[model samples]
Target chain A: MARVELNGVRKTYPNGFQAIHGIDVNIADGEFIVLVGPSGCGKSTLLRMVAGLETVTDGEISIGERVVNQLEPADRDIAMVFQNYALYPHMTVYNNMAYGLRNRGTPKDEIEKRVRKAADILELSEDQLARKPRQLSGGQRQRVAMGRAIVREPEVFLFDEPLSNLDAKLRVQMRLEIKRLQRSLGTTSIYVTHDQVEAMTMADRLVVMNGGRAEQIGTPMEVYERPATVFVAGFIGSPAMNFLEGRAEGGKVVVNGAAGLAAPADIPDGPVLVGLRPEHLAVVDGGAAMLELAAEAVEPLGADTLVHGRLGDGQLVTIRLSGTPTFGEGDRIALAAEAANLHFFDPETGRRI
Target chain B: MVENRPFATFVSHFVLILGVAIVAFPIWITFVAATHDGVRITQVPLPLLPGDQLFANLESAFFTGVGNAREQSVGMMLFNSLVMALMIAGGKIAISLLSAFAIVYFRFPFRMGFFWMIFITLMLPVEVRILPTFAVVANLGMLNSYWGLSIPLIASATATFMFRQVFLTVPDELLEAARIDGAGPLKFFRDILLPLSRTNIAALFVILFIYGWNQYLWPLLVTTDKSMYTVVMGIKQMLEAAEESPEWHLIMLTTLLAMLPPVLVVVVMQKMFVKGLTETEK
Candidate 1:
């Protein structure tokens, strides 16, 4: 139950390699904030700093009101669940959950009461509690890991790609479990993950990071609907937002060898990139003006479909369709996105125009 | 293989018999001799089977009245040997574990220097510096005591090296997880590191037990009193008793007695030793 804040935190290795650039963000108490990005994006490093597992080379990290820059992890009053679930392989599930409490000298009966309560919430039976970690399934081990964190009733919870190690089904299941657990506990949680769906579904607010800098921080829908930067737009969505080279002039954007389209208000006219979400690709509904392209690949996933194709200037792009289109590879198609759905970016700066 | 198993079995037995003889014949010699009359047992065609003089010799081992020299019983000598080996083994293993725990888990100044100290010890055997070591120990006022016998010999640089290597295999996530759970350095060491290293401890135990049991020159140098003699010293004494004409049977029997503790420790902890060695490679 604490707000976590990072004030211009920076981390640099001894050999002069800086991994986390100075970044600042504040997590309000009881908010589930996710740091999402691709591999090597430094999201995990930032999370580890908050967890007090990694040292901050510059600035400060404070849990609630206390600046914990020099505090040990134990003194930080935070609990973290790692991607691998780092269960004590030698201990029974009960002992694994009770270890931190026992370390704090919690009375045996009280420890048992809290451990049993956590186990009940996680749906771990007495029989399961008696079993060692290696005997349990992957999901069970993860729950035991959560149970360990939950019993602490920590001020803040840090998850470093906690569900990344689980299979697809279990990842999804645990995703819901973590969201529910956070909601019930009402503790400030900072989760790091590479998967966008997990971020979108699980984050109360999503902080998308790139190359050691946070690109944007917003509610999940806000990031999805109005990505602050081209990178955020390209990274936040799957079959990511496609970009095509273009130029803006006189309130209008012109594609190379293509029709003129009116630019959004506030677009600067030197050089621009047209950002298009695949789902916005309006396939010719028989009456609308269209841009024709030849489909290169058709991936039908039953509910929706993705059409990967090339435009007139041989610019490669992906088109997402609502219904399975009767389209085949090498077939010609006409598609157009609505003017409102078009996202324009300044070409030179790669920032939203 | 099962249908003609007897023919296959005979082939197996043939190889197995050769292996067993190669591995066990020396042991057979030791055991057979440990149970015989000191004079008759060393004849050219040594007895293929054990002799019946075991009880009398055993009695004589206990009865200093039977042997020409006044000495403590071989039983008392073995007890002394146990105390020596256990002290050395326990001291070295415990110290190595704590030091390894520090080196492997904690980050501090001169970490590499501490590691190099152990590595240097492993690289240089004490035999090269025996006289200086004796001088040091004697100057420390530890002469004629277990501390004198145990201190120089308990460096256990090799065991510490092995433990550090084994400790390197533990996942970083485990340590991070423990840290996040509010376990500090001491609790982490006691609760997680120590428990997970059961196999390594057993492995180190066997290795140190053998090392301590077989220790000779240091113990021989420090322990001057006949009562303070370890089993190995007693065995060497039996060999030197007659000087020019040594008691080979007594020497062999005493040597066999000297080897028993280590052999038993190994047999009991063999599984852990193998696991400890192989798991580290993994």
Candidate 2:
């Protein structure tokens, strides 16, 4: 219901460890912004700062029009779903969902109506509503957690890795459910997760973070198709983007002791790193092969076969091909990628060329 | 359980039985003496068997009290002991819970300093500071009152420390959830924390109740009025009276009554007590 904006938000712990450097992100109303990063990359810290759970060492956060840097979490009108689901272990599902409404002094009938509606939306039956959180299955507990947030009718929702505790299958189901729920509720939500897949699928506009800084923020397709930096290029894809160290010379990238590869025309003559996503690489016929790889291992995943190997210049590379591939270990395979699919970055600064 | 060795099992059972007998011997002797007449109780080695005076001795202890020391009924003393024990137990749990919640959740100046001051009281027990504590109670004009009997002993460090440890084990996420739920401090304490620590409170109540009921030296120093005498200290008065005129049956009868409440509490709530002692949460 409200747009959230963080202007130069930072978090510095009391021990003088700066977990989050200054980060500025403006999320439109009803947008799902997923902050994705590896461990200790300040994604959770940034989310907590927005939630008002952690103090902002520097900068301002605004939920709607009011700057909420000084407001308490309760006063900020936001509800957070924790990674552990954090349901009150002693309270039944009905009471847990009703807790916030009751605390806000909503009328009793209104509280019951909202709780029942949320439970219905979450598909928690009457019998399940009476049970404690410990008695519910892991997926059901996660639903109740979402139900708790849904009944709040708050301005924004904060999910702190809410689906990380579920099994693989359940995580996918809940991920879709959460996406549908957020769309239906039209609530601005900020989800934090270390899993890039969750970030890619759930985020309307994803924020890729690295070393306490926002590396890139854009739509999933945009960030995937055009990653801004080497970190984003390496992090966004499933098998990760393969990087080859080469020098740019006269509008071409030359790998030492290997054949020269095509580079984007705008890239200047200097040390550059070439990135090619695994899915973008194709196994080519003998005559048109652009790069030769010595296959070290092969993973046949039914839908896509992944070939992990070393390139001619001794760089580790992974190539993804559709359906089953007949490639075997130690097979010298020729692979080719279109010039438009290639990513170019500077070796010194790791910035995009 | 892993290996069924008959000889080892037999030795374990035999040792446990021996320990039980050693502990129960005094209670057996007290029971035997209470069942006998005054003259029979005063006889050598006491009566090993019941002597038909059990009901009579119980009635005398309940209605007319033991010997003739200050003429207050043992029933009245038992009532006083119950009041004092309940007050101490309830008061200690209430204060310790609040203090523990404050110390664990809030940030303020001198917080650790105040916690350490409360902790320091553990090193200075009532036995060590009896005179000054007695003076404070007497100056408040609370002598011979229930406040005099319980309040001075209610500020417990052990219960506070136990509750603090319990609160620390609670995940920080629960607090964040509560805060987002719009629950202020008091509501969170009532609806969440108090319920979670229910078993611990019951267990601590058992311990603190027994401690309060068994008080001898402090109650002996404070309550000069016979009506205010608790049953445990009242037993000492009965024993002193028995020195002049042997009323061993009546004295033993009062001693039995004094020990019954705490024993029954432990026996009845044994499950919760064990759960509280061993496990913090499900």
State which candidate has the highest lDDT.
Answer: 2
Model 1 pairs whose backbones collide: none
- Candidate 1 residues A1-353, lDDT tens each? 88888999999979998889998899999999999998998999999888778899999899989999999887899988988888888888999888888877889999999999999999999999999887888899899999999998899988989998889999999999999989999999999999999999999999999999989999999998888899999998888998888878788788755677767766666778888899888778544644667899999988899999888888888988977787689998877788878888776777777
Candidate 2 lDDT, A1-353, residue by residue in tens: 99999999988999999999999999999999999999999999899888888999999999998899999898998989999988998899999999988888999999999999999999999999999898889999999999999998889999999988999999999999999999999999999999999999999999999999999999999999999999999999889999988889888887644557777778799888999999999998977877889999999998889999997768999999999887789999988889889889998888888
Location of the lowest summed lDDT over 10 successive residues in candidate 2 chain A = A255-264
lDDT of 1 by residue, B1-282 (tens): 437667788998999999999989998987788677866775778877888877776666666511322366788788877887888889998888888888998889999898998888876676888899989998998877878878888887777887898789889888888887777888888888887777778877777877887888877888787777778767767655543566555666667777778888988789766865564311
TM-score per model over all chains: 0.94, 0.96
Top candidate by DockQ: 2
lDDT of 2 at B178: 93
What class would a CAPRI assessor give candidate 2's docking?
medium
DockQ numbers for every candidate?
0.58, 0.73
User: Which whole-number lDDT from 0 to 100 does residue A313 have in model 2?
Assistant: 62
Candidate 2 — which residues are off by over 4 angstroms? A257-259, B1-15, B242-244, B273-282
- Residue pairs in steric clash, candidate 2? none
